[model samples]
Target: MKTFNYHSAKDVKEASKLASSSSAFLAGGMTTIPSMKLGLATYKNIIDIKGIKKLSGIKVSGKAVTIGATTKHAEVANSKEIKKAIPSLAALAEGIGDPQVRNRGTIGGSIANNDPAADYPSACIALNAVIHTNSRKIDAEKFFKGMFETVLKSGEIIEAIEFQVPQKSNYQKFPNPASRYAIVGVYVAKHKNGINVAVTGAKSCVYNDKDLAKTLSSNFSAASINNVRVSSSGMNSDIHASAEYRANMVKVFAKKAVEAC
Candidate 1:
């Protein structure tokens, strides 16, 4: 790992100021640290946000659940309020990276990383989540741009994520054998807003399938996915699975999500 200067920000203001420079914000460091360690990334400064007390915890209301940016996956998985309001969401959190990662990784880190195969983005997109940034709130649809990319600007920081509790929601994934990252993961959600089908791992970024959404909106059942065709356009092709194979996995997992729900 390359040596870099580390700075711990006392508050959001300091963090934002530090972020304006060519530095990386240290959340749980689950993604950044590994990349830095592998020489895949280099940064002159590391602004640790661990000192910011406000960016942690879970808040639940009658309408939605708001998770603080620094909230760990373990916290989400064990949150009673989240479990009651959105069990499927809690289940998804529990299924993220394993125990150590769950304990150490922050929601902000996961979202900022925006990994193509990450589980959180799938839920965020499907559940109609609103990403609260230091400057403004962004709809999930507008948050992600591409692989490891987001709409976040320089000096911007993710504050929290608010999810509209779905009437019915579930997630299913086909994981890689060694890394446990998803080969193809699907998140399906149904609510008054209608149905949302967000897919990750099969593409360069988490994406919503309007066609599948229409099908599931018409009928919220596993049978609904049987007739819907998944496309390979812009889908990923790799050693784990081909574009065609991954396309098929979406349908299979969509059915499984229904069953799991």
Candidate 2:
């Protein structure tokens, strides 16, 4: 790994100021540290924001659950408030990687890294969550760009994520045994107005399907998605699973999610 200067930011403003074109913000360092060690990423400045107290915790108001960016996956998984308000999210958190990774990984880091197989983006998009940055609030639909990417600008810090609680929701993931990353994961959320379905792993980015949403919103049943054919095009084809296999799993998991909900 390349040697780099380190700066500990006392607050979000300081962290933002410390970041530069060649700098990287250190949250849990789950993804960042590994990349650095692999020589895939090197930064002249490492702005550690984990010490910022304001960026850690879970808050709930009305029907919304807002989670601070630096909040650990373990914290979210065990949070009673999160469990009561959005149990599916807590379940998703608990299912990430393993005990050590869960204890060390942060929600902000996960979403920021935007791993195509990561679980949080599925929840974020399905819940219609709002990503609060240091400067602006980005809707989940607009936040994710593609694999390992997002709309986050250079130096911009994700502060927290606020999820609009649904009437009922559930998550189902077909995980890869070794990595515990999803080969295909689906999050289904039913709201007063309609339903939202967010899929991950099968695609380059977490995505929502309006057709599936419309069909399920009206029927609210597993059978509703039976006729909704899942296409293999644009899916991620890997050693773990083929695009066609993933496409089939998308439908299968969607049914499972709906049943669970």
Candidate 3:
């Protein structure tokens, strides 16, 4: 890895100021550190935001949950509040990578990376979560652009995320054994207005299916999607899985998610 200057920002404002096109904001450093080590990513400077206390905690109100950007996955998985309020989300966190990765991975870091195979994006979409950044709040639909991409501007750091609680929600993923990254993941949420379904790892970015959502909103059954077909047009076709396979997994996981819900 190339040597780089590191700055320990005292707060979000300081971290934002320290960040630039050539600099990266370090939260848990789960993805960034590995990318740096592999020489896949390089930076002239590293702005450490892990020290900012404002970016580490969970807050739950009547129908909303706000999670600080730097809050670790382990915290989410073990939090009694999360387990009670949104057990499926806790389960999702628990299933991410393993103990060590969960201990070190932060939600903000994961969302910011926007990896195609990452799990959080599906939850974000299904829950209609709002991504809070240093500048403004962005809806999940607008946050993710493509693989490893987001709408965040240079120097803008994610502050926290706000999720609107649902009546029922569940997440299911078919993980690649080696990396534990989702080969196909599905998140289903039944809210007051309607149901929402988000898929990840099957495509270039997390995608919401209105048809599935509408069908499930009414029936709320695994059999509801039995006749539904996930198109293979936009799915990823790699050695691990084919586009047709991912298309099928989307239906399979969605059914499992509905069953879990």
Query: Cα RMSD to native, each candidate?
Result: 1.0, 0.8, 0.8
lDDT of 2 by residue, 1-261 (tens): 899999999999999988889999998898899999999999999999999999998998778999999999999999999999999999999999989999999999999999999999999999999999999999999999999999999879999999999999999999999888999999999987678999999999999977788889779899989999889999999899999999999999999999999
What residue pairs clash in candidate 3, if any at all? none
- Write model 1 residue lDDT over 75-182, tens digit each, in one string: 999999999999989988888877899999998899999999999999899999999989999999999999999999998989899999999899999888776678
Model 2, stretches more than 4 Å misplaced?
none
Best by lDDT: 2
* lDDT (Cα, tens digit) per residue for candidate 3, span 1-261: 999999999988889888788999998898999999999999999999999999999999889888999999999999999888888888899989988999999999999999999999998999999999989999999999998999999989999999889899999999999888999999999999878999999999998988888888778899989988778998999999999999999999999999999
Please provide TM-scores, in order, for all candidate models, with all chains considered together.
0.98, 0.98, 0.98
lDDT values, one for every candidate: 0.91, 0.94, 0.93
Query: On a 0 to 1 TM-score scale, where does candidate 3 land against the true structure?
Result: 0.98
